[model samples]
Target: MKLLCLSNGHGEDVIAVQIIKALYQQTDQIEVVALPIVGEGIAYQKSRIPIIAPVKKMPSGGFVYMEARELWRDLQGGLVGLTLAQLKAVQRWGKQGGMILAVGDIVPLLFAWLSQTNYVFVGTAKSEYYLQDEVGWLPQTSFLQRKLGSVYLPWERCLMKNRRCLGVFPRDSLTTHQLQQFGVRAHDFGNPMMDGLFPEVPIVEEREEARSLRILLLPGSRSPEAERNWELILEAVESIIAREKKRRLCFLSAIAPSLDLNPFCERLQAQGWQQNTTNSLSTPVQDKQGLEFQKGVTRLLLTQTAYHSCLLSADLAVAMAGTATEQFVGLGKPVITFPGEGPQYTPAFAEAQTRLLGASVILVKKPSQAATVLHELFSDPDRLQLIADNGKRRMGEAGASSQIAEYLVNQI
Candidate 1:
């Protein structure tokens, strides 16, 4: 079997490879091809499979204003420029041989219909409502948004209806139900993106573990949101540290490579929280003068890292609501979700998240309230333990990747 995998960024590309790798592991007769949908990132080169359809250089310099909302619109406006390029790649490969597998992007859906290849669209978005509700913060909006939301609804419905595509979702029961409503055939396999999240590290001699309580802090991944997130989270961290001096705080900088971090770090200093750069992979500089928190409060910055490894090492996580929240829950760690002010955390988004997780996770209405919740959670260690226990129960077991891979294999 010759397979063509459609992938976007490194995360999705990694997922594409995992499925292909698993297929190869199962059968040596398998022949694979890769067709990257987004920028020509290192993931394309890192792919061991053949790249019969190489990524084309997208037209550059689509100007986006620095304002968050406007920036998002500008980014979305540029999608058309690459359509022809992507279509050509798909046409060339579709004529050759193989089935298609799309990973969280629309290109595969469009290409599959045009090429008439049996394919599966991994259901990253449960409904048009799902993205609007869960990830409204991104530049894109749902078919329900005031401007672009309704406009795209007819088009989206048409694509899904005609494609005869199978929808694959992360083994979340609620999300699978939503997909069914859209008239697309849906399947739930554990989220393979979270596979191999934790590697067992042998505990050796009496080496002091890094921190008593390793708290993972994920601000939004974009730059505009990062500034606001840094400010809001620092305030909460201050309050938490003051009340509970024994605990240590850690920040995970998962910002995209396109942006800079100094400005955000400087803002942290303004809030009386010094940069603990030593632990961050994204930033190597060390700050000698650590910010003064409550007597026992220490902050460490974890630079760019495999998030799963971080989750594996963490006791608890406070994440700005997004996909990371799900990953934290999958690791059996309780995550506190704050729908911070912005398009991302609107009232609609919060409700959808609550429904999906069945109240297994924590939702904070305001950033100001985070410290109070954290304090309450810390005060009752049993409650935190319950959260962790419940998280694993809700997220289910690992190996979702293998299950999803099997579904894709059947699609061919």
Candidate 2:
């Protein structure tokens, strides 16, 4: 048997990787192919899975609907051509009489349905939490619309209930229940986004001088904007250290593999942070690889290895990222975010994330206010625990990928 996997965004690609890996463990006889819609399938390629569909990096960074300028830029970037080629590939693969796992929103679901193959839909994008009880208010949808569904539109729901779809997997239990209410066969074993994250605990020595607060900085994965976010986060960190002189603050910047660290290093140097190679050695907790920087009473460690370790070690995170933030919150770590002007990580995205993850991720409107927010959060342990518990409940536990793989294999 052959299985084809289709994913839309970077986060979807990562989830696809986990599910694909689980599928591999289920059977060696089956062949798997991945098709990434947004960015290049780097994660798939790294896993030695063959990527059959044509891929492109859009000017919008896969967020075309967020802004009209991005849509226009992507159109000029051969979006139509790339999409047609991908559809043709899916059609040809489906003709081989194998199963397709569509892992994204409506687009992949529709594509797989159109392919005339038995498909499993993994709805990673849409969740009822975005519309119903996220921000203590209802979205401006009609009563009929709410009765049908909030996140999944009527047309999407119709397709999801199609006979060709063998199973439907939703990211959360609420979405699963909503689909079930609509008479669709949906299940939630846990969020696949929370899978495969193992964090190593670090050994600590008693220090009588001052207590340390560890903060992980996630500046995101997109270029130029990611660099810009790093600068902004550094500015906030400087403010944090300046204001709280009593406690020793340690910052760990989790650099995405796709990002260049040169610009980030230059920004830190400009902010008067000096590299301290001999003073602090890289430990296993630091992924045994990282560059250490020191400024006043604060220390910064920059690492491009083991993102899970960074998330595990962080008491709190200052993030301008997307999937990484959700994963951090899934681990019950609270995060602080600042909205930026961009093709991604905009105010709308921040607000959506705030609603999606609940109070686990706090959105600070201004960058300058981030320091104050972090300080306030740190001072209130009860509030921190509340947000952390909310995050745990929102993201759910891991092991969804294995459950999905088992179901798919057994069904086939």
Candidate 3:
């Protein structure tokens, strides 16, 4: 059987890669091709997956909804033409009896449904938590939501309920149950995001590592936007150090390989951070993740090759991201998030994230306020424990990819 994987955004690409990897583990008879609606599908290519269509990196970077001007800019960047070409590609694949595995929001899901072939959806965007938790609607539920019943929205639910949709795997079971209420073929198969977070060698925290407070920094994976977010992050770091000068703080900057390190390093240097080469900052496991830098009692490590190590090494996170923040919370760690000037991490997005993640995320107005939130966060251990429990429940468990793969191999 032939299969086409359609996804949007870097996060969706990564999730699709996880499922594809699991698919290979389940069976070898199927041929797979990927169509990353956003970016160049770097994650797919890294895993040796074939690209079956032309993909473009738009000016909005797939966050056109953040600002109205971003959508206009994408149109000027040939967004319409690129979309038409992609639609043709999908139609051709459908004519060949190729099934689709859509991982993301409406864009990919709509495309998959339009393909006229059997398709499955891994709903990574909207969740029932956005409108209501396991109980009822949130306090801030909009007028539209009170009537809609589900965060899947009316038209989105319609697509999922279609007979052509072979399966629907939501990020969490609560969402699956809600979609099932609408007669959709939704499954409570955990989430693929939690998988592949374990490195070959886990970073062990002992001795000095246990003494210092560790923070994982996730600015994001997008290009220019990530570079821009770094400024606010550095300021937040300074704010954090200024308030708690006595504590030994370890900051792990989990840089994506796609981003240029020179820009980040230059910013650190300008901010009076001295590059450190000595092994004195022992990580207890593998020789610290990446290059280390120092300023006063605080140590910052920028790592590109050790993504999982960076996530595992931190006790908390200062996040301005989507999937990365969710992944951090999935580790049962609380995140202090601040809005950024973005095509991605805007105030609107951050607010929605708070609703989606529940108590796992602490949203602040500005970067400078991060330190204040951290202070309060550390003050209450009981609240911290509750946040941890809420996070693991929100992000769901790992191995969803394996389960989905097994189902597809046997059923689809």
Alpha-carbon local distance difference test for all models? 0.57, 0.84, 0.88
TM-scores across all candidates? 0.71, 0.94, 0.96
lDDT of 3 by residue, 1-412 (tens): 7889999989999998898889998788999999999889999989899998898899888888778899999999999999999999998899899679999999999999889898999999888888888778899999888898888889998899888998999999899888888899888989899999876335766676447788888999888989999999998999999998878888888898888999999999999998987766644225354778888767788888877877887888999998889999988899998888887888889999999999999998889999999999999999899998999999999989999988888766
Off by over 4 Å in 1: 8-10, 38-42, 48-77, 105-107, 127-170, 175-185, 199-211, 246-259, 271-297, 341-352, 379-386, 393-396, 407-411
Measured by TM-score, how close is model 1 to the native structure? Answer: 0.71
Candidate 2 TM-score to native: 0.94
Model 2 Cα RMSD, Å? 2.3
Clash count, candidate 2: 0
Off by over 4 Å in 3: 200-202, 208-210, 278-289
**lDDT sort, best first:** 3, 2, 1
Pairs clashing within candidate 2: none
Tens digit of per-residue lDDT, candidate 1, span 97-193: 5777777545556776676666666644343333332334224433345453322254654666565555545345444555466664666665665
lDDT of 1 at 207: 28
Best by TM-score: 3
Clashes of each: 9, 0, 0
lDDT of each residue in 208-285, candidate 2, tens digit only = 465477888999988888988887888778778877788878888889888878998888998898887684553324
